[model samples]
Target: MSTKMIFINLPVEDLNRSKAFYEAVGWKVNADFTDENAACIVVDDNICLMLLTKTFFTTFSQRPIADTVAATAAAYALALASADEVDVLTDAAVAAGATEEHCPDKRAQEAEVGMHGRTFIDPDGHQWEPFYMAYQAA
Candidate 1:
């Protein structure tokens, strides 16, 4: 089977700020798909996120978009190469204006469960979780 690429689309209140936040998390924008109303954030070789302005995004859906600030329909989670990478990326996100979803102490408590992750809410109120876990072949 051929590999399928993933493209996650998110509506943003401010395109520039959204683009900056993604950049802070170490994602590069694919200029070929970027414009005033939208930006293509390259998450990895197989994953990409389309950050679209609410006005432009409305064209793709007939239903009213949820106000991210007031409600969230989904949480975008990403898996990283290592636990340290999760912290590094999450720290950068916080420095870039993202609010931490869990406190440092809570994260420590969660690590005891065998999975490690950091969650942050972006400027547009979209939730992003970066996590890491090691897998061993049986």
Candidate 2:
């Protein structure tokens, strides 16, 4: 089987600032897909995030961009290798200007079930949950 790719498109008020926030979270930018109005951040070989300026984004979508800060635009839940890794990434995000857990209940994952995670809101109000699970299904 071939590996499929997932590209998440996000609208940002400030392109440069958003790009810098993702980088501070330990991902690198794919310069080939980035320019003045948009940036492609390579989260991994299969995942990428395209941060587009609001003006540029409207060209692709007819609907009004949701006010992420006021409402839930999306939740990007990431599975990491271990609990420590989850903490590291979330910590870096917070240090890079991300708001740490607006919803305190979301800060911890299913710890009783051997999962641990931390939720954070990026500078642009996108929510990200980095987690680790002890069990894996076949």
Query: In angstroms, how far off is 70's CA in candidate 2?
Result: 1.0
TM-score of 2: 0.92
Compose the digit string of candidate 2's lDDT tens values, residues 33-111. Answer: 9999999999988999999999999999899999999988888999999889999999999999998875545434375
Which runs in model 1 stand beyond 4 Å of their true positions?
103-113
**Which digits, one per residue and each the tens of the lDDT, describe model 1 over residues 1-138?**
449999988999999999999898899999999999999999888999999999999999999988878877788888888889999998999999999887688677656766688898899989888888665410
Best by TM-score: 2
RMSD of 2: 2.2
Give the clashing pairs for model 2: none
After TM-score superposition, what is the CA distance of residue 89 in candidate 2 from its true location, in Å?
0.3
